[model samples]
Target: MSTTQPQHRSVIDAITAPRDSRVAFSVEFMPPRDDAAEQRMWDAASTFHDLGAAFASVTYGAGGTTRERTGRIARRLSQHPLTTLVHLTLVEHSAAQLESILKDYASLGLTNLLALRGDPPGDPLGEWVPTEGGLNYAIDLIRLTKSIEECRDFTIGVASFPEGHYRAENLEADTHWTLEKLRAGAEFSITQMFFDVEHFLRLRDRLAAADPVHGVKPVIPGLMPITSLRSARRQVELSGSSLPSSLERRLRSAKTDEHVRAVGIEVTSEMAERLIDEGVEDLHFMTMNFARATQEVLHNLGMAPKWQAAA
Candidate 1:
């Protein structure tokens, strides 16, 4: 898989588009757990392209287990009509290794990346170990990415947490860190999933106030379609993301997968609609290996056109 070089835009140009603009729609995907699964996932991704997605993502694993595979997929996807954003973590590879990985991506014609401080192995219970010469912060990773003219052309993005980071001293500290990341050359932000809109709006306002110079990137909100009670509860507990009481009640009342999935779809549809109503054009879905629920959410929000409407 190979991609043609992308147009080079300054980081600023890449992030702050005209206000209330509608851009592209995308979804993030993790590598499959096995070869058979990988093939199936690719087939599904291909179908998404045929459905009119603006772009798609391929994720690097927790311990960076699928780094190479992620790159390969990114290259392949970049060749498609859609743009490709490759997720990168700075926790498991040395600076040299990291650079090598980036160079490989560059060679493959990938020009978009999402820099993240990935969950350490056995996350929520295990300690994170930084690889020798690897960055401990996303800002450092952003700076490094910008230093290479060869790779500087990439549209680097950082992760945002609307409800505050998992281990921040406070929301203020999280906001400060986010500023640092932008200053280091992140072109955009993709937020961690949150149930409420206020959290995102508040953070956006706070960040804008703090850094009037660089300006805030278009922090595309992440929308996750909740389909199972067990999964929803687990996600909330693990990420510390709050679930609205009403949503929780609905989930609790759901006795079958269909009931739970329906409730989840309704809640997410409402959220996406409100975001769009607020003038948010770009939405990134955390698909969690299922296509239909995500497809449904986008369709209900009017982002998914007839070609991509849920079947």
Candidate 2:
């Protein structure tokens, strides 16, 4: 799929503008670990850009291990036709160190970011230790990002959990924390990957009811189409999210790897359609450094670039 490049706009604007009726779509990418992987990442980014992604994001590694590579790729992506969102976390860096990193991002002209209180370095489910002088929560990180002089014009986004954050006591507690981040200056949020649309709707409703006066900020649903049952199980385990038994049964019933992929695409496309119909303003796809499955889902939804149909 291909198309002429659209006029540049911040993803914030695309999602927030009342007059713009198109549903915004974005993709998330992780930093590549090697030369070959980097090449693959770039190729996938290029294809997604051509396929009309509103923006692209590069993830920060746990413990900030991929800090340099994340910045490099985010800077490069910013130079392309797509607006790039960089992920920032309070994992292994001190307050001073984080400020310096923000300065580097500013110098690189990166204006979009996703602030997070990342997972513990070696084990995500393990105990989390706050860095000596760093922030302890994502809301604090959001405030720190806004405090940067060079980041005055930056659009900050934060993470949300449709199934509730793993460590939160319950969904109510999770929603409260999510509201705190928005009140702290996060302009929008993208949820952790979830299989159930009802989960997202419930989260959205609770947030809306929480802040009836100012209203809730935009919350984009995040999706990862399952191509393999084993990988899907691992992902859900890591995220502390549940896989619906019905969907799992169907996937397990597939006779071969190719059939599994086909089921995944169909399932994801159906979910996307339902969300879009239910008035979701945006959709954030977790690309996993690969684009074919995602591209297929988009195409199946008739949301693929016009050229894809010709191809």
Top candidate on lDDT is 2
Per-residue C-alpha lDDT of model 2 across residues 133-199, encoded as one tens digit per residue = 8889888877887888887777889998988998999888988888888888888889999999999
How many pairs of residues collide in each model? Answer: 0, 0
- The C-alpha lDDT values of all candidates are 0.74, 0.82
Which 10-residue span in candidate 1 carries the lowest summed lDDT? Answer: 1-10
RMSD of candidate 1 to the truth, in angstroms, is 3.5
lDDT by residue (tens digit), candidate 1, 1-311: 22434433333343334432354567778877767777767666765665555567777875444655665666666566546778888766888877887888788777687888777766753566777777887777777788877798888888889999878899999999888888887867888889898897888788889988644567788888888878888888877788889779888898888999899998988888777777664777888766778778766766554334334
Model 1: runs farther than 4 Å from truth? 1-23, 62-65, 305-311
- For model 2, the superposed segments whose C-alpha errors exceed 4 Å read 1-9, 16-22, 63-65, 213-215, 305-311
TM-score of each: 0.87, 0.92
Q: Which is the leading candidate under TM-score?
A: 2
Displacement of the residue 23 alpha carbon in candidate 2, Å? 2.3
Number of clashes found in candidate 1? 0
